[model samples]
Target: LTFDDCNKSDRAFVAGVLRKHGFGATFYVTEGLGFLRNKENYVTWEEIVELDRMGFEIGNHTRTHPHMPGLSPGEMRKELLHIEKRCKEHGIQKPTTFCYPGFGHSLSCVRELQRLNYLFARRGVGPEFKDGGRGGRGPAYDPGVDHPLLVPTTGYAGPDWKMKDLMWAVDQAREGRIAVLCYHGVPAREHPWVNCNPEDFRKHMDYLGEKNCTVISMSDLSLFVDPRKGPEDPYAPIRARMKREK
Candidate 1:
């Protein structure tokens, strides 16, 4: 599972929960927002470093969260590069993985990311939520078949998510596929739309513990991906069509 946007107030709470469960998470941070000090503020550099000390993956979520598709190529590159630079300055390893701010993406931005040497850039929601249906984020992500830059999540667990939805996602991890759950703020009072109740979050963690599911940080999934294989060439189909036209 991964958490996005550094909510300062919930940092300790979220970290404590993960520690208790012996699980790790990737926290996608935006350092530009690190100045404010309140429930609505991003965590400080010290807190980010502490999370790193606790073994959580500190990933790039840009220097300031922005709509990627709307930014120029230079602007987009700055967003990613600045975060990578900040992580290193803070004694954290350069972030190899990235998450799109607001699920925004563009092919041009992707190209820039490749140039900057990011191993992965995640975007998009996972499965559809249904009532009394086969609840899941659809087919589990097969690194062999999917594009590395556009990893999908099982689903977004918000304030309204129930235990069943969480369990359904975990169950989908079977058959060599992974259920990547996207969580925003754990019980974020300010962002009620994406806020997941603290108790519910605990229940979800408890469920994972009871099921004995292996909860890994996003970076760890790299073990299963073969760098030799690489992501599919985006222009291959276009090139093929042009050749056929000839």
Candidate 2:
């Protein structure tokens, strides 16, 4: 799920790539940015509506894209709920997923999201397993979190750097783990904060296809894991058998 700070010009570009491969993406929109203001750095609200019409889920990322974890309770509430409202205002009702800006979340962020009835939130960390691999890298992961509201993501940014991240995710999924990729803009524009080239994006998608991993959004993953157990279930047996102190 991607297209952070997207613009109208690249909407079709990103959409075409994914559609060609029989996959779709969910775009989390930042309020009042980009095409909404008709600015030089974003896609239009019309374009977002079009994407929504094209089987893509439009989620919220707060208006003005602030870090809620740092804000006061009142400010955090204002930051997230207001955006959630705007998403509804634009016909994206019942938006269930949210991504904190810069992966920033706090007790306040979680509370506010819960208040707004968000079912899942995406974080930026994964479990640490010493799976056999090259030069000290570890094993992949499976989803189903202790906190269903907080999910993890594997982001792919540069074509070169992305291949490694993709391989890691594929490895984990092959071992029956879940890999949710957190990514940003497409078509390679300014702002390193929101820049990913088209070709680079394709590499990650191609990897998913080749690896045969079911590409899905955060909510889809929740349904994959057994709620009775949690994210820690997969590693439970291993943890007990390995009694040697680290």
Candidate 3:
């Protein structure tokens, strides 16, 4: 499981609930989305440190959360480096995992992440699964088939996501496949499109706990798969899937 943005609820509400269930998750932090000016909606750097101390992985979501495809390579590097510098200042480990802001990604961004030595990077479900707009569904991460830098989100819990959608995502986690779920704030006020109610979030967590699912943070994937290994052609799996589907 992964929570995106620097939502204040991450420390206040989400962490406590996950602790209760003994589940591990990643919190992708960024100063973007008015995080610096808005204390009510976003978390402070100190709160982010507290999250790291709680043993949760703090992944990079860039500094400004720009549409990655539009940024020049140099611009992208700056956005990523700013977050890395901040994490170090707060004593958080240099993030080995990254999530594309707005789910906007490109081949250049993937190569950039690789250059920075990111072990894993998460992208929203797309191409493989026709994007259903906000909170879309997509295929599970098959390490053998998909590039580590192009890890696909199995489910994104936005307003449209329900218990049924959650069930479908988890059900896909079997054999050699892993389901990766993305979520914004629990009751994301500013971003209504990606908002997930606290009650609904709890229900989803409870379901995962009840079913004995092995929930893990994005960085935890290194335990099972070597980040150094991936398809020689990073886009090969995507093209293959697209062709097969067609």
Candidate 4:
């Protein structure tokens, strides 16, 4: 499980629930999206440190959340490095995982993450499934076939996502495939589009627990797949999957 955008509810609500069930998740942090100015909706650096202390993986979501495809390599580097610098100052270990801001990524972004030595990165399901806006379905991560930098999200929680969708996503975690899930605030106030209702979030977590799913952080993937290895043609698996679906 992965939570994005440094939502304050992560500290207030999400952490307690995860702790209660002994589940592991990654909380991707960033200073953008009025995070510094809007404490009501976002988490503070101190709270971010507390999250790291809680043993949840803290991954980089860039300094300012921007569409990565729109930025030059230098700009992207700067954005990522700024977060790394902050993590250092706060005594949080350098993040080995990254999430593309707004799910906007490109080969340039992929190369930049590789240069930074990120072990894994997550992107929205696309080029196979049409962009689902905020929450939608996509292929599970097949490490043997997909690029580590282009790991696809099996599901993202939003207004459109439901319990059935969550079940379908988790079901894909078999035969060496991983179902990577993305979520925002349990009750994301500022970003209503990606908001997951608190009740629904609890139900989802409960379901995972009941089913005995081995929920893991993004960094945990390294234990199963070598980060340095990637398919010869990154998009080939996606194309083949699309053809099979058709």
Clashes of each: 1, 6, 0, 0
Q: Can you write out model 2's per-residue Cα lDDT over 1-246, one digit (the tens) per residue?
A: 545545543476777777777775667777644435655567766777777787777777777777666788788777777767766767766567777765566666766776777767665443333322111223333443335445545443433344676677566555455556656656445455445667777887887777665666555555666433444333343243344324
Most lDDT-accurate candidate: 3
| lDDT tens per residue, model 3, 53-126 | 99999999999999999999999999999999999998999999999998899999999998999999999898
Residue 33, model 2, lDDT? 47
Misplaced by over 4 Å in model 2 are 7-10, 32-38, 125-141, 158-160, 225-246
Best by TM-score: 3
Candidate 1 residue-wise lDDT, 49-132, digit = tens:
999999999999997788998999999988888888888889999988888887777678778878887776677552222322
Task: Compute the lDDT of residue 207 as modeled in candidate 3.
Answer: 97
How would you encode candidate 4's per-residue C-alpha lDDT over 1-246 as one tens digit per residue? Answer: 899999989999999999999999999999999798999999999999998999999999999899999999999999999999999999999999999999888889988998999999999877677766768888899999999999999999998889999999999999999999999988999998899998999999999999999888999989888988998766677778889879
Q: Against the true structure, candidate 4 has what lDDT?
A: 0.92
Q: State every prediction's TM-score relative to the real structure.
A: 0.85, 0.77, 0.98, 0.97
Q: Where does the lowest 10-residue lDDT sum fall in candidate 1?
A: 126-135
lDDT assessment of candidate 3: 0.92
Evaluated against the true structure, the overall lDDT of model 2 is 0.59
Q: Sort by lDDT, best first: what order?
A: 3, 4, 1, 2
lDDT of 4 at 137: 82
